[model samples]
Target chain A: MAVTRETLLAFLSKKTRADLSKIEDGAELFSSGVVDSFVMVDLMMWLEKQTGARLNPADVNLDNFDSVQRILAYAASRAR
Target chain B: MSGKPGIVVLGSPRSGTTLLRRLLDAHPNIACPPETYLLSAAARFLHADQFAAGLRIGVLDGLSFAGFEEAEVLARLRGLTFGFLRDYAERVGKPRWAEKTAFDAFHLAEIRRLCEGHVKFICIQRHGLDVAVSLRDLVDKTGGYVQELHDYVRRYPEPLEAMARAWIDTATAIAELADSSEDAISLRYEDLSADPAAQMQRVFEFLDEPWDDELVGRALAGTGQVGFGDWKTYARSSVDRSSVDRWRSLPEPVQVKLAQICNPTLERLGYARIESDDDEDDADAARRRYEFGLLLNRMKNEDS
Candidate 1:
């Protein structure tokens, strides 16, 4: 199944201590300091495990993983 | 002398010391251990070996010199520490090495003497309220907030207050020491967070190492979990810049208690007193000054 933005957001809200209410689909996560370096690692690992998607170090850039929408798109691209 | 320049990253615990260590370690020219509380251990060992022995065993993972004479113990420990650095550098294939430990701040004089002019120090500072909140959060997560805080207070008697005082004191000490030597730099965690690439570039320049743009970009991208455990789902929450006014966030009764307890140290550190306009009738600026004076005297006596 292609990962949807809602699915990613739901998983993130449950997994993280962060209040994701303000996090829109295309918001900048790191730039906003909503997610720090350590949490980014956790989010990536969760995405991989939950979706069976393998993410390379190069693919972990802020451009790809900066927001729920972007992350979902990256995962969808990998699935395709 | 044996390899490249050695760096020491020192700060209060939970003040982004480990993160700075990891960031610098990601640099190609530098190497650092996972974490070491050596300097703090050294201070405790000098003051009271028994207490230091327990800390060494518990926190340092059985690294101790409990049953030896002071000079012999210090020499042995220093040798072991330097040897570990050398081996770590060789293993990592790096010419420069760095080590992070909060306790090192307490024993800056001793660390300087031991490194024998081979070390550069990077001191990290974070807002005290955030530090306190982070500590509380970790304790709650680990399921031992009360017990841990109680144990910490039992050991240190005034861990939070002492920690706040130490943060200012250590920073002042390092700043003073650095005035005479070109071997230290202080960086605020907030500033580092706000502008990581620029801050990291300054860090590399300070160490006289070549900056690797790719590594910096990767470090900025951050390593996704190599594996998972308790911290697997941990997400860095966005901090409200205005949250530094944590004094106003607590209940009135708690705020009063905190003000009473931490007023002297807070004033000493130049933090303005939190006074409610509604309660201006009860505020005593004169008494606060007198109490601050007394606290300063007490601190001087303890230091001497």
Candidate 2:
């Protein structure tokens, strides 16, 4: 099952309690203080379930998971 | 003139050594460097099985072959290591130096010989369960101190069990050292954090140093944050009881496991064994603890 952008956005929106419209697909989450590292751990775990692969600690960096676009790319790469 | 008896602070990692180091460093007569691993390294060289593979001899024998007698080796090693610390003290206009290093408890006999019987140890012990919890959180979050913990991990495999074993081993070493040596003193982390001034005064009395409110204030202020130790101390201004029994927030299973691993040593050290029977809310409590730990990390990052 592919992780849809909308689904990821919905998860982030619920975690941040922000409107879906406020968060950009390309906007930085942790770097911008929009989402904390704790939420990032939750998101990584959620992504692991969605992607069916254990996310490598090396791959779990700010550059890869800072935005929805980057996270989706990471998930898609793992799916491949 | 022969130097004064040296002070060495011994404790397992995360057992409030950082707070203790800063407090000792604050004293006008003593200079305590942050997280000096020199003593542990000295202990290793003296006791560890280091062989010269090609030469088919022990490393100490090889050193002997290379014209360094065991006594001379220790004398030089002590001079070279503690020499730097003494210089650090003098540079700062202090007369004495103390070193707080991890794993220093494991080889107290060697440390005693290395320091040529002119050393005093202040061993700090904390509750075993709380130490396991703190060690787990520290490894999970920062990926720091892995090298120091790797040997225990290899033996125990289970992370909490490894941490519990570390706490037990350190406490046992400290107890034996205190029993065998007159210069060694032990203190509890709970008591120190709860009433820092009183505990510090006791420490001063043990050291035969002058003590007063002014020294205690400087220690509590904890100004210098130089070397590699306890990033948390850099955020807080003074020690508090906030971290005394952190194991209570962890799941019952974890508490029980840690308690079981170190109960004998814990009881020996006057810490009550944990009685965690509540099972219904273990999962909920663990989740809350996890989130709280994360929130704390976030807050600390923000503060710094």
Judging by lDDT against the true structure, name the best candidate. 2
Residue B25 deviation, candidate 2, in Å? 1.1
lDDT of 1 by residue, A1-80 (tens): 56776777766664455568667788887557676544455466556656676666456565677677788788888874
Give the lDDT of residue B6 in candidate 1.
Answer: 80
Where is model 2 more than 4 Å wrong at Cα? A1-80, B50-57, B65-67, B106-109, B276-304
Q: Which one is best on DockQ?
A: 2
Q: How high is the lDDT of residue B55 in model 1? A: 50
Task: Give the per-residue lDDT of model 1 (tens digit) for B1-304.
Answer: 3456688886655566656765787787787766555555554544433364455333123334454454556567667776787777778798777887644666766676555466787877665545555554555676653332454445555445434444555655655565567777777676766766677888888888888766645543444423221131112222224434543544333345445545554454345664531221134533433443354344334435
TM-score of chain B of each: 0.63, 0.83
Q: Could you tell me the interface RMSD of model 2? A: 8.2
For B69-148, candidate 2 gives per-residue lDDT tens digits of 88788888888888888888888888899898756766666777787366788888999888888888998997755665
All DockQ scores: 0.01, 0.03
RMSD of 1: 20.5
Which 10 consecutive positions of candidate 2 chain B have the poorest summed lDDT? Answer: B276-285
- The TM-scores, one per candidate, come to 0.53, 0.68
